[model samples]
Target: MKESFNKNDYGFWNSPFQAKDLASKSISFTDLFIDNGVVYWGESRPDEKGRNVIVSMHPDGSIQDETPPEFSVGTMVHGYGGGAFLVKENQLYFANSKDGMVYHKNLNTKEINPVTFPFEGRFADFSLDSKRKFLYCLRKNDSTQNQFPPTEIVRINLVTKETEVLFTGSDFYSNPSVSPDGKKLCWLQWNHPNMPWDNNELFVADISSENIITNSKKILNSSVGACYQPIWSPKNELFVTFDGNNYWNIYKIVNDSFEIILEKKSDFGRPMWISGTRTFSFLQEDILIVTFCDNGMWKTGKIYLKNNGFVEINNNLSTIYNIAADNNQFVMFAGNSLLALAVVSSNIKEPFKFKILRKSLDDSFPSNYISEPKEIEFTARDNKSVYAFYYPPFNPEYLKDENNLPPLIVKIHGGPTANVDCLMNPKIQYYTSRGFAYLEVNYRGSTGFGRSYREELKGKWGIKDVEDCLDAVKYLIQKNLVNKDKVILAGSSSGGYTLLSTLVKNNKFLCASCTYGIADLIAMTEHIHKFEAYYDQSLIGGSILTDKELYFNRSPINSANEIKTPIIFFHGDKDPVVNVKQTEKIATALKENNIYHEVYIFSGEGHGFKKAESIVKVLDKELKFFQKYLSN
Candidate 1:
């Protein structure tokens, strides 16, 4: 048995981690919560046709699927759905993706019932008021009223099946949190031209006996910089994660004044891309467990209320999410380089150790096969520092050839606002274990570093982000870490725009792959979801009316003729974020110019690919494209 575990020479590019296996074995966990000692979470399974199932773990250490096979728990409230399910007592309420209806399931009797009818628009971020027998949530309005849908905070009577709009003037709404006593409610809202992370306000209102919202006032004003995750502690005090000082820190409202609890130059909040994002939980009246981003790496820790002292918990997790606490115990979705993303639980007294309730992927593979990322910083073209996570080639069975440098895969994360951490991502491993050095760039505009860093790409979207990617590649090549001639570029969504923009400015990469990337900034500004309706306005520094020329000049579609590298384009026809026309237009131009390229438009996919077959097909196509152009 020991001899069988020994390394063998299979060489790079012949990795056992095939794309088909990764697609089938991979699971995405989200929206975690704990109730009555039962830990529940949502799992999006690719192998099951992207069916999202609600799973539960009992104290007896038994795990079971709470969602029926006929239903998929998901929502389209923000196009990037979240907070799809919530639990109260023995009832599980979730939004079914197939018909966009909210359903209530009796956990004990296993009887499913629809609570909301179709045409009521989509809903997410649910908060149950058991005393009032009402379910509060954020709902998107039908598009019939306007091109971009408006969002509202609404409450539905659990008994009468009637929904009442609690508030409506905002362009977007999320995080409808009911107070512990169910006598008050708080939520986050922002107007157009501002993302939830860019600039949003938190408001609180007292509920009347007639269920009317009374004395509704903005608790945390918009000027306080983007506020997120308005959660009430067990003591019923209103709290939020504020970024007023550039770093997201936990702040509690004490007599109309914001008091920072455990002040640190780290982000205790994340961008509200999806609904129901929780980063901190009160384990007790005084001790709080928080997942914070410290220097781009995520860490879980405990904050003592007595003196605002913090102590990091020692767990085998680099990234943490959806933290929920009950008394001394807390559960969350956490993972690190050696461990796959899983539902883990730990107590306040035993923070150093945790038990994995469920894993997103099988971690039975040999530990030696894992390639841990090294967080690196380098000077960019603009002379500012850029951050990235570099994963060197590692295959237990394969030995490196000192004479030759490995090909490099430089990735640009989407959301020009999003940041990538040292999590155990199978896609990154698939390339690294196959003799490829993977560089995941957390460009200037990415979150977690600080608000200033996140706002770096504002008005200079194409320039700053593209330069950072170029600088990262230059830094890696100059360090003799990767083969200069074999560097490849890849990105999706906004990252894809960066990839395309980078290709236009330089001819460094041998080839590139872009998935659902924006090609025409002007077109995108004219047609996109309300969540990002004004996203390009901030990115371009002005609206289309004021910056038409900048939009045209910065858009990669207009400069498609300048790109000399062979690129493959992948897009979803049903993408609500970046229109499929974005990719199709660029491909048409490339074909017209006789540039070597391939285009694949997956059916029934949104901004991101979810179906296992689609993911497998895309990965296979990408690997084949890279191998065809990779030079030794």
Candidate 2:
């Protein structure tokens, strides 16, 4: 029963892909931690108001009782939080997002109590000391008056409810790890001018007789490029992942000098957007397992320290997001083209046979409708080659005429700094299954290629991104691969900005649909949070004070009067990233200019849409609008 070639034709929205499917589909796992024999993870469930629920998995692959329905274990570290929950034995320590307080719960007694005093401080990246009855963590004080948020390391007396500052004087701090004997502490720090991924240092200090850190020294200097994730081996040797050579590789410190342990031209680490992240861990004293992104796909492998040999882990997963390991096994949240995101555990020796503990995909979804993307590379502006995942309309039941090209949707991913991975994203397939060709472009600034490629958009954000996106659409049309007249542009967050900017500047697309998107570059600086206060300076080349005209000229809203095509804007009323006012202003401009437009504001949603009903309504509206405008 092979699909299509022997069957009838089916088109976009003609199959089982539904708008409700997007509402229920949740982000798999943000972070994972393993303790004793259980694995704990934070899940972003939109059905639950996008609450980050903490779930535990047993060794036998059984689902344990999740965190109390009232408690969603998440941290507000750096605005985008990871390392939210940590578990030691039957004890659970987590930062509650609602209150910004760290709470401890006894798994046996089912009792939860706050350990830190209530304040505006957010605590995360928990490091437990089994022998000292204390827990160490990174804390960020969100001060209202101060321009820069202050970060410090603090230790909490679990029993006494006392908090003591261990270290301070850093603009940002993360990964505060304590040695097994609880005698030494090590962590990562960086300043305001540079983000963690750009430059950082590792520090280590010995514990004193009075239970205070004494005589700390910088083990990894910032001049040596970005270094982070310092972990003391069982033999007390320090190992870290650094991008000293433009490639984030594993290095072990020997006599205060780095000794390359696992050499590869791939990223063994990721951008430090949050407090805690891990790419590898010691599977045993002599063996370590790690995951790295070579191009855009993720793969896992184990390094044998004894022989300095590397062996790839044989698995069906295309992406290994988070990994945690013990002496005998490794657990991770991984995904492939066929399977939705799932939490799976594998034995250290085999590393192939996996047992699924939990998954995001349900039985109701149609696997046949999922569109498998084709890797595409097209020459763009400045003679630079751009990359994208081009997915044509796919349905097992549908066949189409070769000459009757399908409509196209050029999707711009958010995080103008982020890149898309090779995985089965149902949201992307939603359009492809309905007779729409989809393209997820990797512009110049997107990561995963190399440091040089990522830095290409440093001061060319709006220009390069807009040029490359339009180039992608034009590339497909020239080859007669798509319907030139029905091509549309869409994206969220920064992606939305790129889409709208393209629509306004080139007047090439039929219409544009953006969600919580940025329009006014100058206004973005006023609305963004502390984590990204000077972000525009890096992307736009100068502060608002120095380049007022440049910001105004690049803003898409300034060209709203030039827009003759219909546009629809979706914004969260509570969004703080790019404030709700930015989108509202564009909507106002569109209406005043007599342009066909629609605006839907979700009340409780924040920077990103979070509720199931909200996701459903916005998506349905966007699809209907797409259909209405494309019909013309």
| Best by the TM-score measure | 1
How far off is model 1, as Cα RMSD? Answer: 2.9
What is the C-alpha lDDT profile of model 2 across 1-632, one tens digit per residue? 22233111222347576878767855557778777788888888888878888888876767765677787778876777888878877788899888888898887797889988887878899988867888999888775456566777999998787888888887778889888778888888887667777778888888875788887988744345788688877776788988887778888877666788977888888777766678888888888888888777788898999887999877877777778887677888888877778888887857877877777766678887788878888999689888888888887666665647888888899887778877887777777887788888988988777666777888787889888888888899898888888888888998988877787777767887889898899888877777777767778887799889989988989998887778888888878678999889988898899988998888978877778898889878888888886565
lDDT (Cα atoms) of all candidates against the true structure:
0.85, 0.80
Candidate 2 C-alpha RMSD relative to the actual structure: 2.7
Candidate 1 structure quality by residue, lDDT tens digits, 1-632? 11221111211356777888888888998798888889999999998988999999999998899988889999888878889999878789998888878899898898889887666478888999888889999888784677777788988888878888888988888888888888888888888878889888778889888877898787644345988888888778887889998999998888766788877899999988888779998898888899999878889989887788989877867888779998689998888977778889998778889998988886655567789999999988878888999999888666676667788899999997899987988888888888888999999999889999999899899999888888888898899888888889999999999999999999767899999998999888767887788888888888799769988999998998899999999998999999999999999999998999999999999888889999999999998888878633
Q: Report the C-alpha displacement of residue 389, candidate 2, in angstroms.
A: 1.1
Which runs of model 2 end up more than 4 angstroms from their true locations? 1-12, 25-27, 143-148, 220-224
Measured by lDDT, the strongest candidate is 1
- Candidate 1 off by > 4 Å: 1-12, 143-145, 220-223
lDDT of 2 at 627: 83
Q: Each prediction's Cα RMSD?
A: 2.9, 2.7
Residue 224 lDDT (model 2): 54
